[model samples]
Target: MDLQISVFLLFILFTAGHSFRCYDCLGLTGSCANQTVQTCPSGFSQCQSLTVVIQVGSITYKTKAKDCAPFCQSGSINFGFMKVSYSCCNTDQCNAQDAPDPSNVPNGKTCYSCDDWSCSNTVSCSGTEDRCIKATWIAGGKSVKGCASKSICDVTAFSNFKGISCCEGNLCNCEGNLCNGAQSITQSFLFLCCSLLSYFLLH
Candidate 1:
């Protein structure tokens, strides 16, 4: 009886430690795949990201929406299952959803562009996270937020470091209004955060 009880306790502990929901809810880009759409714009809906990538030959333009669901919550409707209507933003990829009007598309652009591929909804504890940006500011073009997730809007971080901009965690980093322009801030913050590590280890 004692051995059986111990085994059961161990299983419970393991299970509790392993259960978690990722930062991303769903969709290849963590762009609010579980949200529904609206038509009349009565109130607000679940917040979701919008991204578009346009590729013509070699050059590509990208656009990302910080949020979209709230803009179309009035006309939201249930399809059949829990698939939910993503019609808020018009795109070939979004069938049941109210996609943004393609006519609104700017010159030199496509209507469906998203780049959050390897991004896992896998929840993570306090630590460095990926920071990616779309290629262009246009509607769903081509972008590289350079993070596990594409848009900077859907970023999730602990309160300890949430003060930093989502663009702060970028890798391969390039020149831009994000991190590249704030080199001094990055270095200063790093030094402050690691001062203890440097002192303790060196000592």
Candidate 2:
């Protein structure tokens, strides 16, 4: 027992004393050109790169970011109008490559999208976007709908927010084009959703 305890202590000390490095950069465009070596803080065991795409009507914006994370799950999140993809590695400067753009051919699924007050518009779902999501902005009493990947619909992802709901099947988040008019949410719930979105954007 003593020998095992001592070995465990030595292993912990070795890991704690080791410094991990990663390529760090954030860009509003599709690619990140300038990357700096960043020494990760303790508890951060992996390097991560994330790509996000937000589409509003005919306009589209994409951003790429690289940083250190305590832990990261490689996956993708889709919110009809927005999409996020993540990649992770466990070695020094391993996040040298940014996540790829998520532009898969349309997968024949369609869902309502809200670019303005009218949530009547629809967009095609692509790739792994197999779910429908609706989120109400409590402050504005308005709701937005879109196609999402099943990964983003995990219960733990939005457990604290009541304004957001995700469902499986086509147009399953709501039954009609004017679904936003009938749904209601609290301001606090929207705030939490925005904060969660911001964390992904800034971090």
Provide the overall lDDT of each model, using Cα atoms, as 2-decimal numbers: 0.28, 0.70
The sequence of per-residue lDDT tens digits that candidate 1 reaches over residues 109-146 is 11111222321112211112233222331212212222
Q: CA shift at 36, candidate 1, in angstroms?
A: 15
Best by TM-score: 2
Q: On a 0 to 100 scale, what is the lDDT of residue 172 in model 2?
A: 69
The alpha-carbon lDDT assigned to residue 34 of candidate 2 equals 84
Q: How many backbone clashes does candidate 1 have?
A: 40
Task: List the candidate 1 regions with Cα displacement exceeding 4 Å.
Answer: 1-53, 58-95, 101-143, 146-152, 156-165, 168-203
User: In candidate 2, what are the lDDT values of residues 111-137, reduced to their tens digit?
Assistant: 776553455567788877777777653
How good is model 1 by TM-score?
0.18
Worst 10 residues of 2 by lDDT: 153-162
Check candidate 2 and list the clashing pairs.
80-147
